[model samples]
Target chain A: MADTVATPKAHGHVEHHDVDYLHDGSLLSWLTTVDHKKLGVMYLWSVLFMFFLGGVFALLVRLELFAPGKQFMDAETYNKVFTLHGAIMVFLFIIPSIPAALGNFVLPIMLGAKDVAFPRLNLASFWIYVVGALIAVTAMVTGGVDTGWTFYTPYSTTTDGSVALMTFAAFVLGFSSILTGVNFIATVHKLRAPGMGWFRMPLFIWGMYSTAIIQVLATPVLAITLLLLIMERTFGVGVFDPKLGGDPVLFQHFFWFYSHPAVYIMILPGMAIISEVVPTMSQKTFFGYKATAFSSVAIAIVSFVVWGHHMFTSGQSQLAGAIFSFLTFLVGIPSAIKVFNWITTMYKGSISLQAPMLYALMFLILFGIGGLTGLFLGAMSVDIHLHDTYFVVAHFHYVMMGSTAIAFLAGLHYWWPKMFGRMYNESAARVSAVLVFIGFNTTFLPQFLLGSRGMPRRYYNYLPEFQFLHQVSTVGSWILGLGFVIMAGYLFASLRKKMDAPANPWHGRSLEWQIPSPPITHNFHEVPVVTTEPYDYYRPFEPSVKGHH
Target chain B: MWLFLATEILMFGGLFVGYGLMQSVYPEAWIAGHHHLDRIMGAINTVFLLCSSFTMVMAVHYASTNNKGKTIMNLLLTLGFAGGFLVIKYFEYAHKFHDGLLPGRFFSYHGGGPAEQAMFFGFYFCMTGLHGIHVLIGMILISWITLRTMKGEFSSAYYTPVDLVGLYWHLVDLIWIYLFPLLYLVN
Candidate 1:
């Protein structure tokens, strides 16, 4: 039996002309392009800049620690380098890397929307972030802050550094973060397309939704915490100053109240991107879709109670420590479920080893190591031993570097065609991914061993015995840096070429694939009505395009 | 809109947590701290903020009905109250400065244990300083609303600006209510 399909007329004419590709010629137009694709690209370029900037600081820190004994700089200079590294990486890079960039670009398109709910506000949030980042960098140039990113009090208040200015910069950045969170929450709640039931929404949206909740609820606390620190530093407020009869531990309480769940904020969106890429490339519907979606929410909720785990050795009550440890362990279960679900999606399906798939595969292995090591830290006794050690540093890098950074690169590669309307060098992209994976492990894996062997973190100089691992980590950093440069060069060069990517470049099933490449302003001509579940691969693959180009 | 208010509450709620914890641990110091505050100024600021909130709501009501004249009138009233709050705060801070009740290592009161007294004055300056910034922001909003009302920009159909301003004014009043007790009524 022959199957017939509705084919377009053979007059060599397509039905629709590509709408105006450039944004409307107004400053406000570029400012308010809530076109998820534009927002995503903005986030991508901004965060990549911050990542390299932060990496530069990390390189300086590693160089100073290469053979110990202050070979590179004095304690004060070393203090600034490591502090800037942590502050820039945490506040500027990791926090906004995946979610704001990739998630902003894809979530609305996947949901089949014209734009986020508040387009103007989205632009305002981005500019606010830029302003906040400038203020932070300005603080570094003007005397530099040395209280570390945590800004633990007493010393923070007493130190003769630029604590007030730096804390206020961070406080302003918190407002930017809060605004983005608010925008995302409102968008997800009010902006899904018709017939796209909540359950049928992609796991990326669910992950973003959960992350938005945390961003809204938890970020304000950090804002207040930073505000208090600024007040304490500038006005000599007695809130966190021990000499003024204030409990320094109170600062710890306020800081970790936000910083603890901030870990989830850093990782949840990356997990969301993985959720999207895994099922599509594997050619299978995500197993336990609802379970995977719910796990994002579960992690967001559970992450709140587990923040006390960071304060376990900071003189918290034994009961509080136990409860936190238990909650931390409980949080692990949802993450494990996600891991299992991703692996199960690849079972007995057409698993394609695309560039994104390579990153996703590595994400599972790396995030697994990151997540399991977290359980070891969640145990009070083990954490007490590894607290503030290189082990802690290695574990977080595994999650932040291995998982979020990898997931970010995967999303970048996956959506490159869609965003720029051009295809990158896939072979070069795969090689960079491999280099990053190997270099990242070589850099951080030894830190875990050194941490287990009692090497402390954040020190300007270390004992000679730990020299071998530090050198290895430093070498690994250079490789990692080189890998990033290659990735950037290739993606940047791709933009100059006139490669036409088809709408469904990967033959993916999401709503974004239904639109034109380099989507028009106001996204879709007519809003798409989603009629099937995401990742529905059971039926025969129906190429939705009307005619082949 | 209410969510923004919730965020404001959490922001101040953090300061209150610090206040509560300090009071619990150092009841004597807190009571002594309250003795340093000018209750008269605190009470006047409270009335000023309450009146501002009332005028802000009135402006919203007028804006909803497209009564541009009354909208401008109420917004001016709100701005007047915000100005009044700032004037009173300036006097209070000036008086404290004259009394030499400064904060930190620079504190210079020759009274017995003036060091402890500086802690009290420190919280006072910080809390009121932050409140003053809020009052300044409120005044700016009120001025914007007045200008907008004069231009006939708002209507019953599109009054999110008016409603958001009302919410912000109410928060300013709410923060003063908490500040009144923490800064003045402890004794």
Candidate 2:
């Protein structure tokens, strides 16, 4: 059966060649495309631009913190700058960075299908994202929200900025997320090619499957939370406002209830990228494949119960705090399982430190630190001292930026060839990776120390004692920005050169590599019948090219 | 459809949990507030929604059986009941408005039993208002399937739209069943 399925002429030889998805469409067509790949490309560019915008805000924040007393911008401007940085990065950039951008392109192809389950819905999600982002930018240009991205009550309700519009933008963005989740869930369930069982599917799909669950389950709560928040502000509903009959801590509970799981929504996709990258780069079958896959789901499940950990110092009862602390630590078990499996996959295996692999390796080190620091904050005693401090900021940045953003970069490089049919300048990419590593540590490592020494987060000014570490962190931002500039330089440079990449540049055994580099308007000539595991590296290289163009 | 429904449940679930927490916080206020909510009107609206759910199920059944006329008729009945539900809800809102039984800062009723009665009205308005929006959306969805049914677009083999809308209508009904007891029958 496997022999019969793998025949190159299984379909027919005289296949009509449609142009690749990128070239098939006009500008108008691109705007209205239902093709998964084209949508993915649009999402990729959109997120990248948002990343650049977010990075600028971050640079401004860091620049303001350079001397601490007064920078070019005053304190109110500093608040708005940091708020925009957090809002843009989380809502516009990181949340969609990997899944909606890269996953949209790859998941359908990986499933050996023409497109996602509902391509039109997929397109709708993208436009919805655009609308939401536009609204957010509108809010930014118009007074700008200073309530931080969390939009906690009392302050959020009282803030004079365009809090309502910003929250509405976030609300709209949640719809896009929900729609994408719905699309992915359907696609994964129904669209897998013949013989592709749940276990045989790629680990990245498992990550996405789990992420979609969280997105579907948790995002609606955010929608309602924000809506109720708007009500609290406008009508004085008092759900979150303490000046009325409301409890402000209840707002914290509501925010984190959705948000704590949201952290998984951000990271699980990153871990998913590593699951693919570590095995392909190491040239080894993934270690503890079942464990690694199940851990993704496990992390997602445990994520819901630990929202209270975020409110340890917010006047939550000791009993609830203790329970939350314990549940939070339980997350470490599944998370640690993944880290161990990734490391062991690389052990005694052929390791290639390509740009993608370098980023994967960085994810391991940074996520480990990030995950471990999270446990410290999870402990009720420690969180009291560290809560709302620079430590918390550094911890999240390490996870959100260091881990998820790095994994996104890894995925971008790993699939750049398949995505664009061009290989970037390797030396430059590797140099940028090293610079990012050095600069990231320099920027965030000192903040952990600064936080422990009683320096709070989101402060416009800092004490003289904190100025030196702050300056060092600011300097680190420059190196990080320079690294990204070089990255942009070479990647765009690769696009100009002709298509030089082979179908399987990394000799990856996945179904995606068995097809064309940039893949046709329709992904596969014939739907692939998977007869083996995705990471069957030990087997001889067999390109199951079903049909030729 | 189930996944989308899951999101809807969770969204309303947030409001439900908030309602319960605030109820426990101000039990006397909640009990006093419930007195203003006429159980008769609430029960009447509940019946309308439940009947609409029945009609919706029947519509789906007829669509799956390829009974186009019956499907359309049942769907129209569902829409009528949904409209009836909204009409009753409108009158309930009007009554509350007459008595100044408003939410939060707008609570102008001088005959309140507790100050937190305003908070009770807040939950009442927020929960019902959100649910009312869902009901309105459900009407639009039912109307859509009904139009499709009129065009003979659905058959025994392809009634997914009708079936999905039925599920949504049922959920909307189910949420109201919970809401009626929680809001109007506090005892």
Top-TM-score candidate index = 2
Candidate 1 clashing pairs, residues 3+ apart or interchain: none
Candidate 1 - CAPRI tier?
A: medium
Over 4 Å off, model 2:
A1-16
Which number leads on DockQ?
Answer: 2
Predicted structure with the largest lDDT when compared to the true one: 2
Q: What is the C-alpha lDDT of each candidate?
A: 0.80, 0.90
After superposition, candidate 1 runs with Cα above 4 Å error: A1-16, A19-36, A540-549, B66-73, B110-114
Per-residue lDDT for A389 in model 1? 96
Instruction: Give residue B5's lDDT in candidate 2 (0 to 100).
Output: 85
TM-score of chain B of each: 0.93, 0.98
Residue pairs clashing in model 2 are none
